[model samples]
Target: MTLFSREVELLQLEQDPDPGVVVFAFDLETNGMTTRCDILQIGVKGFNWSTDEGFVQEFNQYVTPTNEIPQHSSRVHHLARDEDGDLVKETDTPGNHEKLETLPIKAALTNMWEWLLKDNPPVLLVGFNNSRFDNHIILHHSKICCEPDLMDRVRSRVHFTDLRTVLSQRGEQGNLESHYNSCDGPPLELHDAISDCTAICWVLNGKAVSYDELRGRAVSLESVLQKKNKSSHPLLIGKLVTPKVAEKIGFITRENYLKFSEEELIRFLKTKGVTKISITLCVKKWRAVSYEADF
Candidate 1:
């Protein structure tokens, strides 16, 4: 299915709030950075500020992984396998207790989706750097688990606001720890998914960022996936080389673009009066796409 882009508007709670809109701050802890990695935990905290609702809904689940959690990842999230090969929470991990019950990846995903869809209001998911990481992991696992219909439902109904992007645009630090500290947010245990979700809520409220402003920056899951796919295209279509630009540059097809070496492409673009900055970006996009293609 093609991605759809539609306008989303969230009303200010103080001015004119819409009780039908629910803003959910969510987070996911994964085994690794790649899409192939398994999600270890999912956490969410939501509110309907229109009704002065405070943390109306909360969800937290630990996902049992099919593969072993790498030491590097375990070091960060404090979830690892013991000598018996059973999943265990590391000692003194924040927000984690000694007793941990985990669900299979599919079950965790399904449960989370069910919880998110329980309410009738339109859902807006807010996360820190989710656009680059957590969102993709969710999408990837959902696809592999044969939950395309659920994912489609989510794409059509739920919206996403990348808190990191919003903060960066406002010239504030984008990383959660830095942003949280800057806003004088309460003590937060950084890697815990639920704790991170709470921190996002705190930062949003501290900054007095209205839901309307977040909605203005929100995007659909489909659009996010589409942008990601476009970036990986051999020609980097819609990213560095649009159709019109490709035609103008005598690189009308992926094959034409691939025919030139990086040096050759840079020289050609220079001849066309492309600035050095644009040329650098073009090369960077090209290399990223090409690198992905190699694998």
Candidate 2:
């Protein structure tokens, strides 16, 4: 039997108006910054910006992890305890809590897919810097817990868009916060899954008309950026380089990217002027994570 069974059809998409299109933007808070890391929370918000009709649905879930959250990762999102024996966040309890009910990784993923596939499938699957992070993690876990066929079905029907690419193409100083502030978006609870999702959507709405446009822009920008990289440095494909160094090569998995020392991280930034996984315009945080940067 195939892994995933639920598949969403395009369903007369060509006839639909721009305002009728559904765009789902999501974010993930994880125990660490890798595809192999456990997902801590997921937040998704769907809306049609053309009509400004607001969200069709907003979903958020907390997932219990099988592994303990690391000190570095906890510092970023505060999902686990630190060496001082303090919980990452006061509200983040060990087990299921009142506000955020915790579920097993597989169960949470199944629910996430169900919520996403409700009524009609989202025309676009968007995230701030999802191309290299959230997408990989979701797809990785979904393969084991959910049906691979269902995951494939979902993939076949939806288009993926990364808002970070758009900001990078704009040039000068760029990051999620600056763009969000420029758009007059509300203050964000940084690192929170749902808040990040909302912030990303608002920023996206302030610019692009639809997911198709963003996808096109991301593709064009990626080509331009990669070509520029090629001009400066030889392409380092399929080489057994250090994890920190591998990011310079392009989109390494989290497992491979995190295996570096402080010196390597510093050396990479000072020399390359950009993180391996991110450009100067878009600063890399945790595994393809984009945050504020001094550009």
Candidate 3:
């Protein structure tokens, strides 16, 4: 009777889960505002909600620009070429000192790309005003460096989340520092790329906005660029003119620029104090546009 009754046990099999996407909050300290300017430093802090207890990875690198760091920009980030022709970045903390080593833009960007894709998980790039500024610089440099693979990967796998826009939607106002202060975040060292990235992570990690909300707000960088292109003047897209020059002309988009005659264009450029060489460049670019239109 005891042998007739048998007990069977079933073992549950556990399958490994796929790697979860990472949220990489990044910041770039640049030589200037324009895409032509160089990125002095790139700081990234990655948070993997699935596995990480806090920021799991950090990447900080100094980039040596082909151009000299402008004094105005240096004043902000404390990065400059020392008397020995070596690049140096001063620390924000008065007593604390740090060594600064630089990499060429191509090497720096490649390293950054490697770091971002290390886990082979999809990445969400986040910044305070990345949609307009940071993303553009990244895309532009990627193109300049002829990194088709990086551009393709960025277009496909990497998406951008602008914390400034997200916070604005949430009814929180002001810059990154302002938002961080609102969250009662830790003491922030402004202007340094690493500090800024950490601050961004702190703000997003705060009660005001959850990480889930940031994920929901993510958008492809290509879409954002496409939208901007649609609204921008063709010359601006082609880099025939700078934004500062465009604003000075009082014609932002191609449509507005077309409304004026060549004479009016020259007059406006003169009044705006645009350099004679730049005025010639603008007029030549305008005529080239007209010629292309004829085709």
Largest TM-score belongs to which candidate? 1
Report the Cα lDDT for candidate 1: 0.68
Candidate 3 pairs with clashing backbones: none
- Winner by lDDT: 1
Worst 10 residues of 3 by lDDT: 3-12
RMSD of each: 9.8, 14.5, 16.8
User: Which prediction has more favorable TM-score, 2 or 3?
Assistant: 3
Quote each prediction's TM-score.
0.70, 0.61, 0.67
List model 3 lDDT by residue over 179-217, tens digit each: 788778768678889999888877766633555566666
Q: Write the candidate numbers in order of decreasing lDDT.
A: 1, 3, 2
The model with the greater lDDT, 1 or 3, is 1
What are the lDDT scores of the predictions, listed in order? 0.68, 0.59, 0.66
The stretch of ten residues in a row with the least summed lDDT in candidate 1 is: 1-10
- In the predicted model 2, the residue pairs found to clash are 3-147, 3-148, 3-149, 4-147, 4-148, 4-149, 4-150, 247-276
- Candidate 2 lDDT over residue span 55-125, tens digit each: 66788888876778776886677677444433346344555323345788888888878777766454566
Model 1: how far residue 130 lies from native, Å: 1.0
Model 2: residues with Cα > 4 Å off, grouped in runs: 1-17, 50-53, 81-88, 91-99, 120-122, 215-295
Number of residue pairs clashing in candidate 3, backbone atoms closer than 3 angstroms, sequence gap of 3 or more or interchain: 0
- TM-score leaderboard ranking: 1, 3, 2
